[model samples]
Target: MNPDFPILTLLLFLPLVGGVSVVLLWRSPATARVFALLTALAELALGAWLGSAAPAAGPTGYFLYQDLPWIERFGIRYTLGMDGISLVLVLLTAFITVIAMLLSWQEIKERVPLYFALLLATETGILGVFLSLDLFLFYLFWEAMLIPMFFLIGIWGNGRKLYSAVKFFLYTFIGSLLMLVAIIALYLMHGAQTGSYSFALAELVHTQIPYTTGLWLFAAFLLALGVKFPLVPLHSWLPDAYCDAPSAGTVVLAGILAKTAAYALIRFTYPLLPDAARAFTPVIYVCAVVGIVYGAWIAFAQKDMKRLVAYSSVSHMGFIALGIAAWSPVALSGAVLQMVNHGITTGALFVLVGMLSERTGDRESLNYGGLWGKVPVLAFFFLFFNMASAGLPGLNNFVGEFLVLVGTFRVAPGAALGAFLGIVLTLVYTVRLVQDILFGTPSQPMSVSDLSLRESATLASLAVIGVYLGVHPAPVLDLIKVPIALLTKA
Candidate 1:
């Protein structure tokens, strides 16, 4: 809320205003596309600057930290800032927003302006969540962002758009409603104890609640976040939703929504309610390991290409959960890094599926064979992403999963061991997928199209990112250590 540059307000409002502009440009595709890309790119540049400029050690967590009174009586204020962990996620929100827009450039054929407008709105909401130091503001951003996604899936999504959109809405809303109740309870509890009310995260961290109350609060928050992780049984909606949604929409869902949830659990859930998290670790890890194994089992059974990838994400996110449950510092670091790994790798999978569908008119394994021979370039790109998903050596995912497993073995060996078995199952399904889709003989003699220039460029960018992170992750690790060390005190 600092007036100097109004950095936080600028970040939040830019997307809101850009979204409005895109809606106004609804009739012109060319104008809409250009405007949308410009908005996304600008946001990305700003986020990058913010990431680098923020101090390693500062009061509210970053150099840009500041506050302004909103409702003085309630101890509310427009408090916004980032630590290492939050900074990375903010940058991710910006990065994915830009990449998602580019991916949609050629894919979306209608409602261009509305689509991009919603996209920017969604980014704003996500960035708000990452930047806000006030708990109420965080909650507000958390709830507000889902509006655009409901439209993105309903209007631009495929198959049962209404069914999927409504399902996503109801599930998220119920959990968020519970979260709202918890927030109110927190305010009351803080007010009662301190003779003052505050929703600032910094202040709330000091408010001690009984074990029972803390457990209840954690449950409320987890319900909202866990469903988004789409873990195991709660994950039934994902395959259908991702499989049927538009390519860009699927990418955003897989890349951002799930990551947002993972980030939330790490940033807000465990830190705010450490005792509850510890008490609940046994149950949480069981569910996480179950998700890992069960998702792999389902993926192995799926004949739909996109469905396979979707389920794989559930499996990968389960690894994140396990690392979190372990609560070892190293494991937590790996968990943070793995969140990004899942986002990039799975996002790439959806893109490949989209490209394949566009080319050969087949999105299911039952409908494809000898695709590598038909579209070598497409096959090459698809193979790389698949490997990244599988955690092949020298890839982005390998590092995170390895660290998670190693770190967790020291704290929660039982859960980590079970999760390791799940990892083996992961390879089984991923390898089979590659063998079936890329190496098998073609059923039809029809020609398959190669990747377009833009598509290739997009993928190339992703490849470079994977390699860069794989070879040298120290910078990310350095930044992540600060927040994790701080959160440990909670």
Candidate 2:
């Protein structure tokens, strides 16, 4: 990696450029798929190279920092930086985008080129969110990602696509408006105090805010970020959006998009309003614990496999929230690792479920039976990811969840216990899901094919990563150690 090169800029634009090329250059759907896949592959390679070669830290604890003037009048800049925290998320975004493209290859048919283009555009927005160090830049990316996804769901999704897309838009859009207001307020306050109006995160953190004002501002930011995190009560939009969106759309929604909110909580909220964060710790704990149990309890009753998985995400994300609220070094590390873990495992689950739907033309769990005897390979991968989702010992989710629980127990035992019960519920549903969909006699005669090479390859890659991380997460932990320590200390 050359120090002089704008690697982050390249990473950010590659997908956008690829998307434009897909629209203007590719004539057919087939060529468009190839072009999009190749572009995503290139992005992933670049991310991998950067991850391996980039220095551990740079000035101000950011690697490959880029700061240049964007909107000088308002003190906003085109600032981009990647620390360990953002690095892992960047890689996840790249990896999942590729997976999404791969999953879309055969599934998406009408307006294929447009679909791929929107998907890539969404990628750019997500990558921008992770990399942007300027608050204004971050919010710009935040809203930018929403439009493409809205179209992705509206144009291509299943049952109630338009309704789901609108619901998703309204929830996030309202929250974002609140956040934008808070950002401007913070900028003005900072300017009033220091005569230096800026939306730079580093600068904003030093703003002097009165206690009540800090609490109010933190509440606004929390509502905005929490809507995306879909924290408990605000999560009603998710089940519809997740269940109605196309498989690839669902993967991006559950896998990478939701993680952005959690990431923002770490990057912007806690550091910018430490006093408010401490004050609201108890509230966060309640929401996290409730979300965990409530999500799983609902999931246990879902007849639709996709809906079940969607609700399960609420449960899993709650664990991440729990880890964040714990505010310990170990808990924070677990939350970060869990963000990646949930992406891989849940994304894989959606992929597998989509495959099942493709084969049987149905997503109802009761419609499937004795699939293990019929398609052993698909059954294996399905069970593998399910176990991973259930947080079985020696698997990836277990590592993250264990760390979160252990860390949370040190500070909040009652909340930890509530989360543990949620895990038990998770296990129960996991078994029921596997049994209903993979075992027993079919209710009717239905011919279903097994996994193809492409599908198998897609799942195999995710499975390998899950196993590797489960057995040894030292490399990732090491990468994020310094960043997490700094966050904890602050």
Candidate 3:
């Protein structure tokens, strides 16, 4: 909380250090688990503290700014900063990391230490992505996070684990390479125009780019981030990766990893190439609306719970994309809020799905029936999160989606109408899933034992957050108001 303290650096390194420690204590899985949880808890505490401290935004609209020279010749620096947008995501990343560790505690048995280590390492990479102010540093973190995630899916995953891991890697890596090219192009162009080469975001945002060249650069950036956002046609890898990875891995993927792409779109692409961004709005709106409807429609036909949830993410993310594409202050605020809401609600759904799988060794909706009679507690949590995901009136997701629709309607009624259909489809699938899993007669004998204390506590914490955010989104809206205004005005 100290004004002069390097809190961001500590936050950035804490997980890396913990990961290393976890690796060192590989011989003792128990010790490693305990250590890893403590590290995640510590990081979450730091994030909360930073949020409460509420540092003032600097001239560049960043707070807790830290800049140190790194590869000065290229004008790359170990630069990190936070803003209202970054703060919420930092908190989401920290909170989700802890949730992931908890979810994996029992699920990941073999190579336990390595699993926790990878989770923490991914956390550091994601935090770096959120915090880095230099494009080069951001890309470094961007690529670094993929390795552990690849391993997470490849090693501890189920069904088509290797295939899914490879697909996830290739999709993200190829996109990243394109983005790398774009970053270098932007750097060179800025240097050519201003006689100074820099990958500093603050510097590049002021670059004078030709419209044609900007379009290409923006497309490159969009291709890279869209893959991660898994925007419609670019989302092929999501269902596989989400369905195959272990529950903890799936939670991280659905919860926070995808948000990084949305974050990048807002942070880098839109700001660095404003003209290209505006020019691409129509295209983005089309993709967003298509993804919303297509993802929801596909989800309705899914029999597997994991796959359903995975597809639902594609739908929810589409809604977020639509908001961003709308590019209004209200829509952007909603998008930011929905980012957190999706992280909580969808993350909880995935967690509950994992729990159900653990109990029944199955994830099929049809295979599960009358769970309410068998495991009332688990059924309650599952239903609660499903409604949250469905954007029920008083739950967390409704507020975000409502704002997105309202804002998009003002700008593009057609897109808003399309997204509204996705919402209706969302409710349809949600109700079907609820009825199939919770209300029907048992199709087969399954484990009737309910949630453990730890599982209950985990779901309880997320549920409480969803309720609070749903009822009191004013605080989060206030937090993001200035940043969204800056972004929309820009």
Which residue runs of candidate 1 sit more than 4 Å off their true CA positions?
A: 1-3
Best by lDDT: 2
- Deviating ranges (above 4 Å) for candidate 2: none
Q: Which tens-of-lDDT digit does each residue in 1-490 have in candidate 3? A: 5667777899898998999988986568898899999999999998998888866776556777888898998788999998889999999999999999999888888998899999999999999999998999999999999999999999999999999999999999999999999999999989999998999998999998999999999999999999999898999999999999999999999999999999999999999999999999999999999999999999999999999999999999998999999999989999999999999999999999998888778888888788898788999998999999998888999999999999999999999999999999999999999999999766777666899999999999999999999999998898777778888888
Better of 1 and 2 by TM-score: 2
lDDT of 2 by residue, 214-290 (tens): 99999999999999998989999999999899999999999999999999999999999999999999999999999
Sort the predicted structures by TM-score, highest score first: 2, 3, 1
- Tell me how candidate 1 scores on lDDT: 0.82
lDDT of each: 0.82, 0.94, 0.93
Per-residue alpha-carbon lDDT of candidate 1 for residues 1-490, written as tens digits (9 for 90 to 100): 2338778678767888888988875569888888888888888788787767654576434656668999887788998876788777777777777778878887788878888888899888888887788888888888888899889989988889889888888887787888888778888898999998999877777778899999999888887788888766677778767877778878888887777778777777787788898998888888899999988888899988888888888899998998888877889899999888887888888888887777767776755778787778888988898888888888899999998999989987888889988889989998888888888755665567788898898888888888777888788888888678766644
